[model samples]
Target: MFAEIKNIKSEKSDLRKFGITIGVILLVIAGFLFWKEKESFQIILAIGITLFIAGIVKPNILKP
Candidate 1:
């Protein structure tokens, strides 16, 4: 009952490496599209870069 529900909520799924990689690439490309009119996308690119870097570092950190 409660224990079963707790176990389900406690599980943390691993990040999807392949999908993240593709998204990071797309973000980088979109970041370059600077028309001075489309400004919100730059932040998205920055976040993507940050996520990519974190993804790389996370694996290394966990490895023995």
Candidate 2:
């Protein structure tokens, strides 16, 4: 029972970390787009690519 509880807690923690990482990435991208006066579609495409790459690289990011 305790092991299951610990696993649940760790999963939540990992999700929260991933959320934070993605949020920061988006914010930086938004700032750059604003600075450059770029199109909104470009921002969306950039974010999509960023997320795809992040998914591929997630294990390294999540490692302690």
Candidate 3:
């Protein structure tokens, strides 16, 4: 369920915004996990950061 590039216009669309929100939440969780010295934190941190950046730079990458 993705909209075409031509339909996105100049601003971030709803999907992009939602993705960004989830990414931020994941990042926060990852930070907390890191503070607690959890090993899985690295994986979560990576995914979180990637999603966060992608959500802003290329949101369509997450589609499909």
Candidate 4:
């Protein structure tokens, strides 16, 4: 029981880490896009692609 509880906690931690990493990456991308004068649609597209790649690389991190 304790092991299961530990596993659950660790999974939540991993998810948090993944979220933070993605958030930072997106912020940087947004900054760069703004600097380059890109359209809002382009920024949204970049975010979608980033998330798609992240999901492929870490499917487990996104599990519910």
TM-score of each: 0.44, 0.47, 0.73, 0.49
Residue 24 lDDT in model 1?
81
Which one is best on lDDT?
A: 3
Output the TM-score of candidate 4. 0.49
lDDT of 1 by residue, 42-61 (tens): 77777676666655555332
Give all candidates' CA lDDT scores. 0.55, 0.58, 0.79, 0.62
Report how far off residue 57 is in candidate 4 (Å): 23
Give all candidate RMSDs, comma-separated: 6.7, 8.6, 4.8, 8.5
Ordering by lDDT: 3, 4, 2, 1
> Model 3: residues >4 Å from true position, as ranges?
1-12
- For candidate 3, give the lDDT of residue 41: 91
Give stretches of model 2 more than 4 Å off: 1-10, 41-64
User: Relative to the unseen true structure, what is the C-alpha lDDT of residue 9 in candidate 1, on a scale of 0 to 100?
Assistant: 27
Tens-place lDDT per residue, model 3, 1-64, is 2567555544457557766888899999999998999999999888888888888888877664
**Any residue pairs clashing in model 4, and if so which?**
none
Distance from true location, Cα of 62 in model 1, Å: 12
lDDT string for model 4 (1-64, tens) is 8667656643645765665567567767777777888877466557755655555466455644
Number of the top-ranking candidate, with TM-score as the measure: 3
Runs with alpha carbons beyond 4 Å of true place in candidate 4: 1-10, 41-61
Residue pairs in candidate 1 whose N, alpha carbon or C atoms collide under 3 angstroms: none
